[model samples]
Target: MLYHGPMAVYNELIGQGSLKEDDFQRTIIETLQDLHDRLMKYNPEPIVRDGKVAPEKERGFFSKLSKVFNKKEEERLAKEAEVARRAAIPKGLYLYGSVGTGKTMLMDLFYSSLERTDKKRVHFHNFMLQLHGRLHKLKTTTHQHEDPIPFLADSLAMESRILCLDEFQVTDIADAMLLRRLLEELVVVRGVVLVTTSNRHPTELYKNGIQRESFLPGIGVLEENCIVKCLDGGIDYRREKKTFFHSAKPKDRSKLASSSTMPTIVQDSSTILPDTLVDEKRFFWPLGPDTKKEIEMYFKSIRNGFQVTERRMNFLGRELVLPHTAGPIAMCSFDELCAKSLSAADYLTLAESFKVLILTGIPKLKPTTLHRNETRRLITLIDALYESQVKLICSADGPISEIFGGGSGAHSIDEDPSTMGQLTPAQRQMMDDLGLNDVSQVKKSPIFSGEEEKFAVQRAESRLIEMQGPGWGM
Candidate 1:
């Protein structure tokens, strides 16, 4: 009950029977609605047509002069209004809760209710990826000594005064470092309001990360700049009973049934076969050549079923082949999918192609030997799939936490130099930029390698856990 305000839109929805009346959702919505109002108040620029002021229709020169004077006065008032709005911009809302608790639904409603066109609603991972790309571009194109974060933040502020980020978390040091700076610029300097949702509170974020002390400042910034509220929507909405249908007869009936006389079977017939005539549990047929052949063919076909099918496609000016896909599901090893040079566009295509993804052979991602590129790829893939509502079924060496934890060095980077060397040129450049030349160095500077990856893995782990629940994609 920390949030209290006139939630007009939320109340309207409850009255119209669109949203179920829940205290948790209502409080969060009321807070978000209030933030939305403040954001609108802070940005009072009216829409202009064709990027030019319309001339008055009056023919008199005096009228034109009067119109010009009025325009100047309006401009001054607008400037004053902007200054006042900046000072009065309400603290943004950070809604945290368990999975399927209507956090996203409320955020969506709040985002839609806002009148400002210069606002963005995106998953946090994707936003960080874009920011990283922009930083890289600025670093390569611009001269040294000019930090790109402020410039990038200014560009984003120009585009969107409010950022409604879903699943705000920090697992990676790179992202944590960048995020700390980015949030400072966006909130303090650019006056960009943030409305984000997360599963963890500010104090609990990146709890046991490597060099977590360095990342703790972002938590302070978040708590200071945003109103943190938890939505205790007890039950996960995605949890539902799944209906399963099983086959009545086995595909290889001869192995489990009597083969003396074949009974004529009719589709949809309800007649039960007599137990005395043929024992349902006894096997009478020997393993002949035909039966052996059938079994071999079955296993052989399954082995060859998911052949690596590739289609060349262009993503962000880089030519890459689409990963092997089969119907509404795709199966690939973690290395195959994440080790290669893939981008958000590729993941988007995969999400469009497959409703379910089965990724196997996911080694434990320890902070000591973290696969930076693979971890980043997995993060991007999860962001794309989560946004597209694709169900993920991954088989890792351990649970989500252990796989991405700092305790075990089971899958340390030192275990495989070939895998470490698989980083794309861009990724290698990024690592070099962070001053990480070898695994030993990365181990020493956990902040450089583990921070962003840790945060990203945490998010991916959360989404994976949520996808396993009953009503995930529904």
Candidate 2:
């Protein structure tokens, strides 16, 4: 008999037919494994790493924090401070690419394989919300003049030696402004290693924002510290076959919800099929009562309809109500998700509250005139789910490609070589060399009214199609 040990790496899962092997994914996984090994035996020497904020304060909170992270220098010279720092405190990994390029899967696999209980993984938006909440609480309770960041960093560093943050995008001005300071405090002052994933490159982050120049330093800091690598799997990994490992237990009903519009998964383990194995399409088109009925039937067939109603969620001093939710599943309408004043934080909360979201009535969202705000909100909501690996069930007005209102480019995930037929071979080669995710990243002029919104729709389109893949949600 073949000795099959416990699955750890992507290649192992690939050998078991549960994962598709990709070189890019393998490269990142190797880095993660290395990081894991180092962290298992590594202990940070008590010394402050150099940061932008080299305070001159000699006493009190700053002094205490300085003491906690302080290291002895060879001399007063800055060169000596640089030389005296301990053998690199294990650089963290930052993986970014187009949607459904196996970034999250790789991160999850790495996270699962880690034996360290000190490690914590979180979606970036939710993590920032938590930080903001902590900051706020400290501000209200602590000394007015005292800075909260030092205390916070010490607390966080104590909690986790390694922080694995997922879906690292810089959209919020508050987050953008605060990011560098917070990172300096954590990574430099207190020594918390960061493993992050993103769709946007660090340099491309917060592009075309109000006072964007201010955000540049944070991006620089991110690039300088983290080993930023792009994992472009060429094709959306979602389209691959979903398989159950006989070695592992069967996935919950929610994981079976690979797509919001997926075929109803047969409950019996033996009969369960991957996306390619089934003839039925994931999305329902040309909305009607029959479509609604079909969706309801799926709800019932999957796990009998909603087990509870109006599940209240409180986070960051806000209460969000999930209208109809069963265990690991929630049924939500377009209006509830997109039409309201829901922030990215709220969507993240919703994603965490349930493993599967049944999203209904997805009308055609245009970059130009129609439902721009709704389009933006829906895009954000999809991101939250996609990043969190939540299974999304979408009932829509159109196909995934055409969802952003039919235009010259239907937001085809730019990874497909056939999509760029017009580009010369050398130009394509240059693009590949440069690691451009898609045509959307290359546009010189706005194709529609909103350049940013246009980019967002393209990303959303990519994610929606990727979510339909059999390999998703699992």
Query: Positional deviation of 331 in candidate 1, in angstroms?
Result: 6.1
lDDT of 1 by residue, 1-474 (tens): 543223765675556544457787777766776676667567534333223356857568887788687997889999998778556766888888775566766776677666667888887767887898888887888624677776777677777877888888776677877887788777866677788888788887866654678777677778887999998768543332121101011122221111222332311132221122221111111234553444334323333244445555566777755465544446566777788988776788777666556566667655434466676677788778877655465566665556665432234635566655254455467677765667544444434435445445555665555555433332
TM-score of 1: 0.56
Clash count list over all predictions: 11, 8
lDDT of 1: 0.61
- The C-alpha TM-scores of every prediction are 0.56, 0.71
Q: Which stretches of candidate 2 lie over 4 Å from their true place?
A: 1-8, 45-82, 241-282, 302-329, 387-390, 407-455, 469-474
RMSD of each: 13.5, 10.2
Winner by lDDT? 2
